[model samples]
Target chain A: MLETGRLDHNLGRMGERARALGVRLRPHLKTAKSYDVARLATAGEFGGITVSTLAEAEYFLAGGITDLLYAVGIVPSKLPRAARLVEAGAHLTLILDSVETARAVAAFADLRRVAFAVLIEIDTGEGRSGVLPEAADLVEIGTALEQPPYCRLQGVITHAGHSYAARDLETVARIAEAERSGAVRAAERLRAAGLSVPVVSVGSTPTALHARHLSGVTELRAGVYMFGDLFQAQIGSCTLDDLAVSVLATVTGHHRDAGHLLIDAGALALSKDRSTADAPHDYGFGLLVHADGTPFAQELRIFKVYQEHGLVRAADGALPFDELPIGAQVRVLPNHVCMTAAMYDRYHLVKNGALAGEWTRTNGW
Target chain B: MLETGRLDHNLGRMGERARALGVRLRPHLKTAKSYDVARLATAGEFGGITVSTLAEAEYFLAGGITDLLYAVGIVPSKLPRAARLVEAGAHLTLILDSVETARAVAAFADLRRVAFAVLIEIDTGEGRSGVLPEAADLVEIGTALEQPPYCRLQGVITHAGHSYAARDLETVARIAEAERSGAVRAAERLRAAGLSVPVVSVGSTPTALHARHLSGVTELRAGVYMFGDLFQAQIGSCTLDDLAVSVLATVTGHHRDAGHLLIDAGALALSKDRSTADAPHDYGFGLLVHADGTPFAQELRIFKVYQEHGLVRAADGALPFDELPIGAQVRVLPNHVCMTAAMYDRYHLVKNGALAGEWTRTNGW
Candidate 1:
């Protein structure tokens, strides 16, 4: 169940952070994938939302979100689906890193007689899916995108996803500065080549919070900060108390001798995300908090998990089995909220330690 | 999409092996979670199936499969739900490992005047869940389950999940032997105390495949064998070519300088199950193959993954980017079929290089 108070606090904090940074916050809806959360996120800011999949775009758009940035690198085969969304009166923007993808989208747009806005993805430092900022193909891709009959070069975007590896604010700030400078440089290069690049965007949760300045950047995109997790807590993105999302689990069994309690939330419920393993403090799967969102004994943790069973025990001391009897409910703060949240179809919102409401969530492409 | 030919082969082979071992094959429906696949698995045998959740129990029961074993340990709060399923005409068997759970179920059953059948879970060296075979309280727990007017001790069940850690045939067979002997010994101990323990079950994919004998075991429970994976193949559970499940993804981007191709199948598609990290061969997330299920160059693997982007590159040499251009459809052999399949709501089936059919699957509790 999601704690509504924490959710509101997280949303407000991120909104305020973005406002103070002096950049348009195009919050990525991939983490919370819920209409209600999106509404709260965009309440006092621009309504433009960033999505990771076409399914998400369709879902959010159907829920009345018009402005969307399909943030993932676009594939040629998926152009038809994107075009359909555009034709249906949605302000959809596709992102791509290669000249081949740009040409493919341009051809499809021309053939379908549809106008499309495209963003060139630049590799700041993550080295995952974007074109290198210094690569000659960046300008070539821009030129190919502009040759279209119905295509418009929206701008250039980059995500320093590797900033997740930063353990402190200093390192995160450095990476954020690098992400900003790189995207701004790429946009300048495109403009220098006579390309009408309108928007320059850069972000990830760490970079968004720590960016010294977004001087030449026009917009920022960040997910995960909407609902913080253990990894985020460890990386200084959010405090442990700021984690808005958690898995409500019951104590199913207890091994007194082994000093462990068996919880119903396992790999599927809490997710098999071991992202915090190599961090400063390793939270095996998640940190077990009281059902009311209070802290537990510092040593207790859900150290091991199965398909549908989690072994909760005290890693440093004895487990308080007498205090935590069978059938008692506990909240699990996941290692990565996005992965854990994907396993559930709905969120049971809790406020004042009671059921506040519920929100439907969508998953899969 | 599921490759039907390989799926049929996988099912038929398991059935034959179970018959040869003189034990009933109660296939765990957790992996596929599809009615069509369950039908094939139970075609030439008893229709009894095993599940990991009540949701699976209800889904399969609605599909007309009545006999089911909800293998995960039950918590007290879920009893009412289980009772409702029973009221709906399901011969659903619940599993528990502690006297506390047994008494809880018994009290609820007695209060509701509903007869419930339960199996005691024996640890058998997995150390994940279940009661230790030789624990002094095993008999006490069994006796508690048989108390009052509504509860029956159906039998004992144990899963040697550690068998997945076995690297060679000998280690697998040895762990399998331990699993068989441990469950048998627990049943014997109960019988010696004047209790009638009818069913004796034990298995894991590796143990089921390498069991030396099942002299005291009545039924075998196995899940992932029906859809072999890279981890299974590496641990000698199945041949790499025997893998029936794969994620169908489109080539989204190609990094010529970095020598990697990007696919739409990322952690959400292929799963972040890096189970084979320390195995004989470490397939980062999954092994990439042609859409027709043929292997590509031996070294190309999904070396890195984002939420919706898999970074495919050759670990040893150059990537086959020319052959696998943008928009190419590639099938990814996941590291764990159970985790990967849980992300999709349906399976697109293929047979003999053609589209065979599609099967709807259920997820969530």
Candidate 2:
């Protein structure tokens, strides 16, 4: 379920922050996969968005959003689908870090008789994917993209994913700076090689919110900020109150002796994302809240989860059985909203303490 | 993807094991939520299956499998849907551990004028859910069901989920015995109270496979055994060679300096379940294998994962960069198949090293 008021607040806050940072806020739609959420997120801004999958690209393209960045590294097998999107009038941009993928994307684009705006993924200290800012491969990939008639080297993109591990505001800001500088450096390297480097994209939720400046970066991308979660809250990205999405579960069983309340929402409902485990506050699976989205006086957390059952318990080993009887409705704030939201096909929109309507979302590739 | 040959082998082996143990194998459809898999699993059985959600209950019921035990504890809010299944000629059985839920179930059934087969879930060492076999609530819940004109006391059911943590076959066998005795004892307690007790179900993958005898148990329930995962293989429930399900991923990027190969399958594709973290051999995210389902010469494990990217590294700290270049297809055996399989909408059936067909699955409640 999603709280529309909080959703709007989050979207507005991020948009305002991005405007302040002087960059186009390409809201990553991977968190809130709903087109309705996308419409609200991109309202009063450039319609370009960031997606993790070609499926999301296709969904948003069909929903009428044209400009999109397929943020994850491109594999050859996915090119046909990306090509289809591009042919459908989507300004679909693909990212790659290796010369092999650069060649493959070029070959596929040429064979399909389509053009693709390609970006070189720059390593911004995450070490997950992307070429390092100082690596020779950075310019080599940029040069390779230049050789293909159908593949245009748009710019360089980097994500400071390691910013999520930041325990302090100072660390976040530092990572954010590194993210900005790395992307900019890679873009400058491409430009020095006599190539066009139009777009320099850099951001993650932590980095985006904490970044002091994004000097050379043309655009910023962040996804999880829209639906703040327990992990984000713990890491100081967003406070607990800023969380927009939650799992609406029914109290199914009460274990008085064990001081546990069983909810219908388990691993599948509330995803198996234990991201908050290493954080200052370890919400086992999720933090439990009342139906009206109010936190209890005493802290309650889902201690354990099965496929379809969540074992909830209070911090003090005391449960208010009378107050929270079987059949009572409660909402669980997930550790990671992106993982949790992926389980449901639609979001029940909650407004003014009641379900207003439902927003459908696309899932799976 | 699902290997058809191994799927058939798993189904046959489990069936023979259940028959030898003198109990009905009510194969849990929660793991492989496919009508095609259910058809093969119940080809020669009584056609009864267990489900973790009402969605699966409805899906399987629509697919003409009428005997379904909605294995998860049923909340009052979900009764209307459960009633619809019962009304649709499904012998849908609901399980509960508390009198609160029992009263609510009975009240809903009486109000709707629909009969529901109710089972008292007995806690057989796994304190996740279920009433203890020795608890007074067991008979009380049975008595509550008897008072309702539309609710029938079917029997007792228990799952030894703690068997997953057992390192040896002896421990699993011990847990299996406890699971059987607990359910039988609960049934005896219900019968002693002059309540009709016809069914006694007990099982978990480890417990089911290791149980020497299930004398009093009428049927056994196990799901993940059908799609043996890394965690299961470690716990001795099934061998690694017996694993029938794996996520098909494409090599998207190669971080030669980092000694990591990036796969398109990450947290969303291959779930964030770290069930094997404490095991003897911790397959970080998942175990990578060849596209033809063959193991690599050096053990390659996905060490880190992003939303849509998996960072794979070999145990020897060396990657076969030349052999496993960009765009190469590989399969990853999940840490927990139930969690991993839920992310996918359909399973690409692989038989004899070739794609056979696709099997669709139902997700969400």
Candidate 2 — which residues are off by over 4 angstroms?
A: B147-149
lDDT of 2 by residue, B241-321 (tens): 999999999998887778888999989999899999988889999999999999999899999988899999998858998
TM-score per model for chain B alone? 0.98, 0.98
Best by DockQ: 2
Off by over 4 Å in 1: none
- Model 2, A289-338: lDDT tens per residue? 99999999888999899888999999885888788888898999999999
In the order shown, the candidates' DockQ scores are 0.77, 0.83
Model 2 alpha-carbon miss at residue B314, Å: 0.8
In terms of lDDT, the poorest run of 10 residues in model 1 chain A is: A296-305
Writing each residue's lDDT as its tens digit, candidate 1 over B301-344 gives 89888899999988787888888888899899999899999999
Candidate 2 residue A111 Cα shift, in angstroms, is 3.0
Residue pairs in collision within model 1 = none
What DockQ results for candidate 1? 0.77
